[model samples]
Target: MKIAITADIHLKQSKDEAPERYNALINIIKKIKDEKIDKLIIAGDLFDKEAKNYNIFDEFVKINNDITFYVIPGNHDVGLNQKYFTANNLQIFNSAQVLSFNNNAIKIFLIPYSADNSMGEVLAQNEQQLPEKWVLLGHGDYITGQSTPNPYEPGIYMLLTRHDIETYNPVKVILGHIHKREIFGKVHYVGSPCGLDITETGKRYFTIVDTNSGEVTSNKILTDILYYNENLIMLPVEDEFGYIEQQIQKMIKGWSLSDDELTKVRLRLKINGYTSDLKKLQSIVNDALKNFTFYNDKEPDLTEVNVLKDNERIQIIELVKEAIEKNDKELGLLQLTQNDVMEQSLHIILNKA
Candidate 1:
């Protein structure tokens, strides 16, 4: 009987409320107390809109009051009210929640966040029938016209269709207001564990329902901050500084990031074409991207690099000496200085005149 799903952790009410989003929920409650798991579901925005700190989320539910933190109310905390948060271990689900674990041998179903009923009209005010392998949590927008939008609420609040998961036949339909990770077959969304921006990139999760083999997994949550965006294009030939040092070593080996994981990377580099040497291509892209720290915070945008002047460097050096004399007479090779070595590599280009 395991349970530890999460959601859009917007969490902010200003008071320096973002220590990497409460330190990624305090490392998912210290890996749910080192997998001694007690229960921690939070299928909603958990606060970000008018975030009233709630005593900094009750100082993280008083550290660990034996881990029991169920919360609901997405669309950025819509109609929230659990006595405005005091956290006697934090419960806060306004309505539609029928939970029972290990004792009655697990029986789940919850639905909060209702800016005017839609989640099957609030589970049809609980007719209490679905319990045979049932399991469905909630937040909003489950397909049919809106394929995962809600980056921070822009329309539609609570609407989970698929005929309400085929008329509440729930086998596994946990959800949260789309921050990224998504699935549709059995419905799942457990996204935003970190990287709340830069389009929420790689690795971050918290989902693990298995209330007696209904099965659902995913636990990874080592987020301190990660985001990358790379783009390097420069080939006005003549080995443009060995093609910008071999495309910055293939963009730092496609970010296989080592060297101490490069300080939790937040890169966003972009170096466009044509650089016969713009200050040695900005010193080989600032010494191989100087271990990124610029997610648009500056540099690495050489105004679309364009150095070759003088009539476009004599028409691209006579179109690369007519494609190297048509590949030197179809590879027979010959005594060719190759147009004085393409006019000595466009005379070591550096003419801003």
Candidate 2:
């Protein structure tokens, strides 16, 4: 049996910002249809919020109408005092339920978000006779120390750890919620399909699991088309403003951005120098955005700016020193004194200014 697993497809109605991510998702669905996968499991976070965006579900349903789609409610899908509708082909497991598809030679034990029940207990209670091969589907933290409640926990912290999976040892544990893709034992968090925010940088992908002869083989599929570029410029103490602008222009020339693409571009620039002049740096970044997308008649859009003040650097150094001192005391090294001793024993953080 072939199963395609994906999660955290945060589909938003706003198109001007995330066109690439949306397009990438549509392409991935096409790939899934082409592969003729038996089951498509969206572990969690299908919607960004349970707002009035029912059309998002419509678009999602239209894409995967042919395949058997199994969904589990994520923290984002549950609202405080609201009701949201799920799609037709979508089987939402809001509670502890074991759904078996014997005709297709597939069996799925659905364990949804439960605040009052322990994960181990739920698995023990729902334990039923299994087929030749089965897949366990849910969304939660699969690591011990990394289990954190979702932002919208609704007064209940329902999290699972590695121990829960060990007790209910299924052929494959397809999970979600932790955005970083990782594999531990038989459990796998396929991670987010596309980069949702700036925090989700680098490569993002999903997984395809092939269950044959009671064995499961998983393959990762990369689907991220957007690239985030961050540049930190430490200006010379006495450098001219034009010099910084020229440096930014040089950097922009080396990238794949064009003026038309500048409006859609997401870039962050950090400028650190002796002078308090920041307008020049901002203007330079804006100009670079304009120049790249100039042919397309799009304005350069700068996402963020981090300007460092003279005292801010010193404050950071002091904070680091205090943190180190606290850590040393916690480690049973209370006798250590003197800044030099601390700097020697521990690493001293220097302020650039």
lDDT of 1: 0.74
Q: List the residue pairs that clash in candidate 1.
A: none
Cα error of candidate 1 at position 177, Å: 6.1
Looking at candidate 1, what is the lDDT of residue 198? 66
Task: Compute the lDDT of residue 50 as modeled in candidate 2.
Answer: 34
In candidate 1, what are the lDDT values of residues 1-353, reduced to their tens digit? 78898988888875474678778888998997898888898998877887765776876687778998988888778777778766687787888867887655557888887788888877766756556666889888886764757555677768888987787677888888887777778888988888766667666788888888878887877777777666665656665677568767876776665565557667777776565568888887888767667765777778876766455664575576557556765444555544444434444543322
**Which 10-residue window in model 2 sums to the lowest lDDT?**
344-353
lDDT of 2: 0.57
- The superposed Cα distance between candidate 2 and the true structure at residue 285, in angstroms, equals 9.4
True-vs-predicted CA distance for residue 139, candidate 1, Å? 5.6
Candidate 1 — which residues are off by over 4 angstroms?
1-5, 8-23, 27-40, 44-65, 71-122, 125-177, 180-191, 195-222, 230-263, 273-279, 282-284, 287-353
List CA RMSD, all candidates. 17.6, 9.0
Which residue runs of candidate 2 sit more than 4 Å off their true CA positions? 13-22, 79-88, 99-106, 129-133, 146-157, 213-265, 269-353
